[model samples]
Target chain A: MKLTDLVSRELVNLHLQGSTRDEILREMADVLAANGRLLDKDAYLDAVFAREQEGSTGIGFGIAIPHGKSAAVKTPSVAFGKKPEGVDWNSLDGEPAHLVFLLAVPETAEGNEHLKILQMLSRKLIDDEFRQGLLQAANVDEVMALLETVE
Target chain B: MISMKLLAVTSCPNGIAHTYMAAEKLSKAAEAMGVDMKVETQGSIGVENELTAEEIAAADGIIIAADKTVDKSRFVGKRLLEVAVSDGIRRPEELIRAFSEGDVPVYGQGQADAGSRLKTIQEIKQARKSRQNPVYRHLMNGVSYMIPFVVVGGLLIALSLGFGGHPTAHGMAVTPGSFWDHVLQVGTASFSFMVPILAGFIAVSIADRPGLVPGMIGGYIAANGSFYGSTAGAGFLGGIVAGFLAGYVAKWIKTWKVPQMIQPIMPILIIPILSSAVVAAIFIWIIGHPIAIVFSDLQSWLQSMQGASKVVLALILGAMISFDMGGPVNKVAFLFGAAMIQSGQYFIMGPIAVAICIPPLGMGLATFIGRRRYTKDERDAGKAAFAMGLVGITEGAIPFAAADPLRVIPSIMIGSMCGSVIAMLSGVTDHVPHGGPVVAVVRAVDNVPMFFVAILVGIVITALIVNLLKKEIPADEETEGVA
Candidate 1:
């Protein structure tokens, strides 16, 4: 159920180039797909868009957790992207999200372990100190180390 | 020890991050505020940390934050705040603070009329936990349990008489040894259990299992006129006396420092026997005769009222029936009407029939016309109340009165009084023991048109007066948890 177990160095992007919400989502989804966590990027993106339509995943504090549970997902995994320039996410606080965690969970995921990890991530994001740590982390290794502390 | 406890439910359309996030944030906020809170998360993994009935009953307030539909029925009678899931996450402290500020609306007001019977009973029991004296609490516990028996007996008796009884010079009477006669007997059997069950449960609430035998035995003695040397039995009032006496006597015996050998047998053998004997003896020798005398005297006084002004009698009966809506006062008025029917004074029962239906009918109309004054739940209950009123079930108004006694009780009392006065003035006569339009349909009522007119006037008065007295439900409460 550890957040570190759902993410890796290859999934971490310190400099995300997306200038808009859709571009950020696509960039992060590509990271998940390249890491062999998604079978069909288009289908997974559709699920994320559908979730966004109900309510935005941008839960203020400069954070957005855009997630999708679809059969197109190959494995339960998370892609971390930092857009320091900030992107509009329709957040409750009306702040652009600088830290984004694109979560991919398979429709046929075997157990609740991945969901529990997602819960831990959601809770950790609420902590001001933890968000600061995520924002200040220098590299992929630093990001992984900080996420491991969530357990 | 925490004085306040809160229950919360969190759900989202995606059933993943938001559900758990809201739960976590709420939990953290409650902890920081030093209030006990339990959050049930309806997430992707299904419901976790689900609240139990006992916990829900004991909670001071509730918060429901969900993007998707969540059942609010279970939180009936609780001070509740509902908001979007995003508000739950971003403003958890503010949500909990609403309860402290006492701004939250009580959820499911008047829902007892539309909700499940068991849930209504449970809500009543929970509501009784606060601001009630120990004696009142114990007595109410007994009454709550005794209500079903009373309704069953009352409805069955009404059914048998309505369907099979023939009006004669004496009164309504069923054929001897017939199906309806057996049904009447069955109804009587259920009525016989009412007092005993009331006493037994009261004792149980006070002294636990050891008090049951004595309470029931004492109640039986109280209800039997032979032991008390009067024509009338002691009735429910005397039953209450017996229950308290037996309960306290049993509780007192448990405090005695007995030998080890006898201590083990005290609850099962010694306590039951001694308490039962003590209660039975006390009632038979001291209080029972007085109670029976009062009961009989009250009956005689009511009978004597026949020659007096019918308006005054109708006014008194109407006030009593609507005052508590199936409580002790209501029972007295109802029994008086039933007794009058036995004496072939059908006109006395006529006003009672009208009075009995007015409270429910009036409350139903109040909700209908004053939609802004009542919550959605109350409006739903109003529909059920209207249906019950048609069938003469006065208990349908219990939820409305319970929810807002100040406005609702006075309005219903005035309504019943108006209806009863009209029925008396018109000389409406009811042959059967039942009230409502159903009795008229069964050909048991004379001047059916007047009976309906009385009810209609009463209903309108209640609706208008209650609406005038009650403030409108705030716009936020009416909105529910909008996404």
Candidate 2:
């Protein structure tokens, strides 16, 4: 039930190297694939892009949450990627996204614990202090500690 | 300010993130602002922390942050602020501040929270008003205002007569200058205002404030038959007529395109004076003549029925008593029986006695039988009607008659006629001028058992028929009665 349970050290990137929105999504999707959370990387990326086509996942205030519920996903997982220099993801407020949370939800998922944790993260992102903590986190342990309070 | 509470409902199309996010943001903002608040979240997991009716009713304001449709019927009378889900997340404090600043619109007052804003409150009210039968709407408005006066007057008189009255040769009477006597007079005073208030408010519903003076003045004339050189006033029926007369007259005068200088004083000065004079003249001269003629004609008709069959006579007497419910027609029949009691015809008084109590008793039973057919106030009035019927106060049925005259009047009339026929055929005889089982209790009636049987049959007939004729009042239509 803990938010840390859905997120692992392997998926946490303190410094994202991607300069564009496409490169950042590919990098985050690669992290989920590397952790064996996705069965097919291309199909998962297609779902994410379809969601983006419907509406931008960039929700202003230096945050972008690109989520996809597809059959390619084998397990529910969250990949956290932070860029010191923000990237433009066509956010609502037209601000660059500094904090990126990539969510992978299986189309036929078994439990809703990860979804609940995602909801918690969505709610917490509205708080300036929580976003500040995410941006200033020095290492994966510090980031995990901050996210530990979400659940 | 510390006691204030806010209620909110948040929803979205996806229902996973935005719903809870908006709810969380609003909750956090409320916490920071030190406002007690509850947010009902309608998310993918389904409704959680649902707001209760009590909480919604007690809330100072409500916030509806939804991207999808949210049913707002439950929040009818509450102050509400509606915004998109994104606004709820980004501007939670601002939304709460709208409540603190009292900038929220009351739901059902022709205003919504977000889009589809109504142009003006008056336009919406007028639109709603026009949807119903205007006359029925106006009459209902009058009845709502008139109910309190009826309840207070009926209950007070019933108490005074039941507890402190003695069975007298004339009727039940309390000792002079006693506490019960004072209470009785106070009850009479309350009753005196019943017709005038009914008329005044009916006009208020029709022509607004300008119609009040004329309506009340016309009602005063209607209630006092002496103005028209008649013995009894026209009663609640007459009050209804006067109310419409004054209302339309005032409404007509309001339409005149008068000069700018005169327009300011029109509602206060010109409209009331002119309408009052017109309604008073019309009631006193035009309506009064017909009422007097009807009273005298009924008096002679009853006199001519002296040699008629006993069953036919009982039927006529019962019909008269319940027809207008203490109005002109009722008064004529009652006086004839009282006069006959002076002539040693005790049997004539028996049927009259049974008929007198049937309307109120039947209505009271009807309310009990069909709870959904009457409003909360009417159900309360029903209980009081029973007590008043026991004490032989015919005016107890006036509220019911005034409310649904067509159906209720016919139903009560049939019940009274049946009871009257039963009392007559069973050879029941009442020595006192009064009516009801109370007279039999005081040893004023012969064949006491049959007297009760007559009343029971009448009550059953009325309760069954009225319930059959009436439809169930819709839940939305059961707004809390003004009374």
Please list all clashing residue pairs in model 1, or write none if there are none.
none
Whole-model lDDT, model 2 = 0.87
Q: Can you give the DockQ of every candidate in the order shown?
A: 0.51, 0.32
Q: What DockQ would candidate 1 receive versus the native complex? A: 0.51
* Per-residue accuracy of model 2 over A39-132 as CA lDDT, tens digit each: 9999999998887876677877899888888899998889999998999999867899999999888887776777778888888988899999
Docking class of 2: acceptable
Error of 2 at B363 (Å): 0.6
B439 Cα displacement, candidate 1 (Å): 38
| lDDT for position B67 in model 2 | 78
Q: Which ten-residue region of model 2 chain B has the weakest summed lDDT?
A: B115-124
- Residue A116: error of model 1 in Å? 2.5
Compose the digit string of candidate 1's lDDT tens values, residues A56-100: 999888999988989999989999999888899999889999999
